[model samples]
Target: MNTFEKAAHFALTAHEGQIRKANPIPFILHPMEVAQIVSTMTHSQEVMAAAVLHDVVEDTSVTLEEVRETFGDRVAWLVEKETENKRHNLPAADTWQIRKEESLLDLKNCDDKDVQILWMADKLSNLRSFFRSRLRDGDRMWELFNQKDPEKQKWYYSKILELCDQLQDTTAYREYKILLKAIFSTDAINLQYQTGAFHFEV
Candidate 1:
């Protein structure tokens, strides 16, 4: 099989029956969409492959060494850097600032543009989740977001900016940065981007 076929099969089998944290949507949708997003870029096969397998090492029983053996060292390394040990993920009450810092540090030391693409794609999934949550719970979530009582929305929204700041890709980051600005400026705009109602600025 070709690399793409191998990667797809690997991810599908690895993530079988899994779902997103707050949604019933299959978890594979994220990686699949992210890979699709990077397909708009050149020389991006590994970025696409890495996106499909991005969570395998971190969120699954899979290991980096095994991925290396399967997909080769480069793809394995991207997964390694992108996978954060949950000793790193914060509780909702804890500020996402710490998680943001870790990602920044990781981005700073990272030499691979491939990892950066994976990081941006990961945040794209995150922003998409915000829209999904808002839809499920309604503007009451927005009211709570404005009140900052529960702190979940604050953490999630700040992440959009933090991840945007960490992105070093001039072109893709610019595109996503525009999306972030639009998302923050108006709820209508946020929903527009989230629902594919708006086109990404070329």
Candidate 2:
């Protein structure tokens, strides 16, 4: 099997029992969708492999070292960049914003453009899922997330868009922005980019 096939198998095994909160689908579908999104941007087997393995470290018992041993350093590094640093000693409520902020910083400071593209694909797939869920369940969809505040969700996602602004020309980036606008209404971030008149707050 090629690297991507191996990564896909790894991810499916890692996420065997998990299901998406917004839908009853297997959680492995998220990584598969992310890989699909990344495939649209590049044909690199490593990038696509990393996309498939992105959530294994964060959501499963899998460790970065295992990823390195299984997939090599490049795939491990991409997965590392994609994984959030969840300060385990702290309560999730207390660490949520900090983790997200740090993630944005990593994206903004990333020297590898492919890393950013991989990250963008992940976000696009997530936002697309959220948008579809909202359409089906309306305001009830927000209840599925740990962070229930709509404004905070908007703030977090919008900041990611700002951080990934360098990729604005990509189809994933544009689709992410459009989904954000539809889900959150025309917020300051949307207006700022649309007419260059407003500044985003939070």
Candidate 3:
């Protein structure tokens, strides 16, 4: 198997029986989409591999050392960077904002273009999923997240958008902008999801 195939298999196995919180779909699809998005940026096997394995250590029983041993040091490091820092023994509800804020700060100060591209790919894929789901379910979609407040979610995404804007030249970053603008419009006050009428340009 190629590097990406190997990583994909590992991620699929790690996430087996898991489903998307918003919808009852296989969790492996998220990593596959992430890998595809990163592929649009570069053909680097390590980046694609890392994208596929990004959530494994964060969301599954898989350990970072296992990823490092299986994928190598570089891919493992990229996965670590993509993984959210959840504090040990702390409730996610209590630390959600703090963890997100830390991620934003890390991205802001980050200088590595490859890492930036990988990060953009991940966010863009997530935004694409949100756009599709919102089109189908409207505001009720917010019920799926740990943080259910639409305003708070919008704030977090906006901050991430600004950090991503620095890499605006890339296609993935441009798509990220489009998704944000389409979903977080002023009409949000109407309690109606308007983006459904318009196709996601991403």
Candidate 4:
């Protein structure tokens, strides 16, 4: 099988019985789409594999060691770095702070162009996703930050804009920005459960 196919199998088996807390979409699809999106930016097998197993540690019982044993050490390391700790029950602000720190650290260490491309692609995806979800219910999305929750909104967009500046490739950054802006005009490309996601005037 090709890279994408291999990645699909790896992610599917890893997330075999998991579901997204945000909704139900056979959790494997999330990583697969991330991997695919990253692939469009770089042909690096490492980044693609990282995208495939991105949530394995956080979403399933799978361990980093297990991923290394099955895929490879490099792939496992990237996956580990990108994994989110949603399992924690920290106060809202604390959790968001930790997550933000983790991502910023990892991105700072991303000297490799391929890695930066993947990271930027991931952030771009998140920004576009939230924008649509916001348009669907602006009040709820806006109110989410009333308690000063960093992850509530906008912070992600701001950080992503920063990451985009960190990107060494101008062309890639511009294209990604165009897509990020286009999200306001186009339908929520990746969202499934959220309807009226494009309520924001184009």
Output the number of the lDDT-best candidate: 2
Better of 3 and 4 by TM-score: 3
Q: What is the TM-score of each predicted model, taking all chains together?
A: 0.72, 0.87, 0.90, 0.71
Could you tell me the lDDT of residue 149 within candidate 4? Answer: 41
Q: Residues 2-104, candidate 3, lDDT per residue (tens digit)?
A: 9999999999999999998776789999889998988888899999999999999999999999999998999998998888888869988789899998888
Worst 10 residues of 2 by lDDT: 193-202
How well does model 4 score by local distance difference test?
Answer: 0.62
Candidate 1, pairs of clashing residues? none
Candidate 4 structure quality by residue, lDDT tens digits, 145-175 = 4234424344555555576565645554665
Ranking by lDDT: 2, 3, 1, 4
Model 1 weakest 10-residue run by lDDT: 141-150
Question: Over 4 Å off in model 1, which ranges?
Answer: 88-97, 139-175, 185-202
User: All candidates' lDDT scores?
Assistant: 0.67, 0.85, 0.82, 0.62
Model 1 Cα RMSD, Å?
5.2
Which digits, one per residue and each the tens of the lDDT, describe model 2 over residues 1-202?
Answer: 9999999999999999999878889999999999999998889999999999999999999999999999999999999999998878887777877888888888878878778878888888889888667656667787877778888889988887887766788888888887788778645434444464544332
> Over the stretch 1-202, how does candidate 1's per-residue lDDT look in tens digits?
7676689899999999998765668998888877776665535666678888988987788989999999888888888878765553555336444555676677767656566667777776666665556545544444433234435444454554464454545555665656555444455555554574644443
Model 1 clash number: 0
Please identify which of the two predictions, 2 or 3, would achieve the higher lDDT against the true structure. 2
Of the pair 1 and 2, which is ahead by lDDT? 2
**TM-score of model 1 (CA atoms):** 0.72
The candidate 3 region of ten consecutive residues with least summed lDDT is 188-197
